[model samples]
Target chain A: MKADQTLDCIGLYCPIPIVKIATKIKDLKTGEILEVVGDDKGIKLDVPAWCQATGHELLGIEEQGGEIKVYVKKAPN
Target chain B: MAKKEKLTIAVLSGDLERALAAFMLAVTGASMDMEVSMFFTFWGLNIVKKNEGTMKSKGLMKKMLNMMNRGGSKRLKLSRFNMLGLGTWMMKDLMKQANMPSIDEYIAMAKDMGVELIACTTTCGVMGISPEKDSFRSEVGSLAGAAYFLSEARKSGVTLFI
Candidate 1:
């Protein structure tokens, strides 16, 4: 799937990847998509929880090699 | 526009690790556009102390505790196996290896994200630490009672004690 932008959070740990996602999402327009790349242990739960809590849309999550990529669509206010 | 959900975290411990965890949550909460507030009480107050003039509770025991916990967030004792401060150093090194933010960096991130940092008024009194006299980091706002913060916590979507 395509995204408006990509955030590479590889090598980062819990809270950092999630925090970056939260910060990055603000720059996107409503309904725009952000692709997050990370492999943190918390990402499996944290990314989905973050989207659910913040009302963002989780498009999909795919694993490539050793990295996990999360696609999130910004939600309208 | 709809109202944003908020979180209130009550940091009740002075342990460096728990305080680090608390700040992580605060930053994450605020980053998602949620109003995040942190209430620091008892040992937790050490996290907000400035570089100098740490307050100690009266009596030798409390004084010794203060001596052990002198450096604020910069020099916090680990909750377990501190090893004469070596454990904290090892943990810092581990965090660096993982590309995680340091405790000081986490505090900075929470502040930058607009996390409301409030020191507990009663704890301040119990420790004989006058908020007006003893210095604290600029991140900390005016002191408040538990009742006030508890009220805020009650209205929050989630509240954590750590």
Candidate 2:
């Protein structure tokens, strides 16, 4: 999937990946998509949960070679 | 716009792992755009002390308690497998390799993210910890009673006691 920006959080653990995503998402325009790439298994659950809790949209998730990729769309306030 | 959700965490343990969990949750809650507050009481108060070693206090009992506990985030031992501090050292090494922030770093991150750190007044009194005397971390914004924590917890979507 195409994303407006990408954030690589490989080698980081839970909360760090999510924190990076949250911080990076702020730099994008509303509705712009952010692709978060990480190896932390926790993100598979955290990304969707965080997006759901914060009013963002989780577009999709992909996993290849043990790395997980999550796509989130910024929410309109 | 909707009001941000609130997250209140009570730090009740001085264990290194538990302290890490508390700060991790605090920072994550704040990163999720929630207003977060951490209430420190009893043994948990050690996590916010400015000093890591034997604290000066009046009376033999208070001095002994402070000396044994030595309240500080960096001085905390693990709840399990402490191995006379070896386990904690290993844990810290692993965390550093994994890019996990240290307890002090998490505290800094929480403060920068505007997470409120509140020290319990009752615990302060019982443990002879005086904020006015610089016993507590400067990041601690308030010294409050249980009523303050209860009110904050009542309004919070997530309230956890660690």
Candidate 3:
């Protein structure tokens, strides 16, 4: 999915990737999409769980080789 | 977004891994727009001590206890596979390689994220630790007993003991 901002979380582990995504999402405007790419296996689950918990919209996820890309839309204030 | 949720974590262990987990949860909860509070008691109080080695305590027993423990985040050992601190060193190196923040950095992040760090007053009194003696970290928000933590825990959406 195309996004307004791309955050690279390569090499980070669980919680850190989620933490970074949460922090980065704050910089984007409400309804803007954020594309997060990471190598951490936990990202696939963490991103969706984070979105579900925080009320953000998880657009989709794509996996290529060992890398994963997740798109999340910021929730309105 | 839903209403702001609350998370209360009781940090009861001083081990590196446990401390790391508590801080990780605290920061994540805060990032998710939750009000997070960490209650430090027993060995967990070590994580909030100033790393400076010069903290002095009165009385022979207090001095002995201080010398044996030398409480601080940097001196924490792993609960298992410590290998006399070698394993902890290796684990920290791996964490650094993964771009993970150290425990101290996590403390700073928690502070920046507005996570409350509350020291256990009961533990402090029992352990002969005087918070006013400049032993605890300045980031500590308040000194409260289990009653305060329990009240907060009762109101929290999620409460954990680590």
Per-model lDDT: 0.84, 0.88, 0.89
User: Which portions of model 1 miss their true places by more than 4 Å?
Assistant: B53-71
Docking class of 3: medium
Report per-candidate DockQ.
Answer: 0.74, 0.85, 0.74
How much is A52 displaced in model 2, in angstroms? 0.5
Candidate 3 regions exceeding 4 Å error are none
Clash count of each predicted structure: 0, 0, 0
Q: Write the per-residue lDDT of candidate 3 for residues B117-140, one digit (tens) a residue.
A: 999977875555775537788889
Give a tens-digit lDDT track for model 2, residues B100-125: 99999999889988999998978876
TM-score of 1: 0.90
lDDT of 3: 0.89
Off by over 4 Å in 2: B52-56, B131-133
Please give, for residues B106-160, the per-residue lDDT of candidate 1 as tens digits.
Answer: 8888888888889888787555456552457887866788797979888899899
Model 2 chain B: which ten-residue window has the lowest total lDDT? B125-134
Best by DockQ: 2
Model 3 chain B worst lDDT window (10 residues) = B124-133
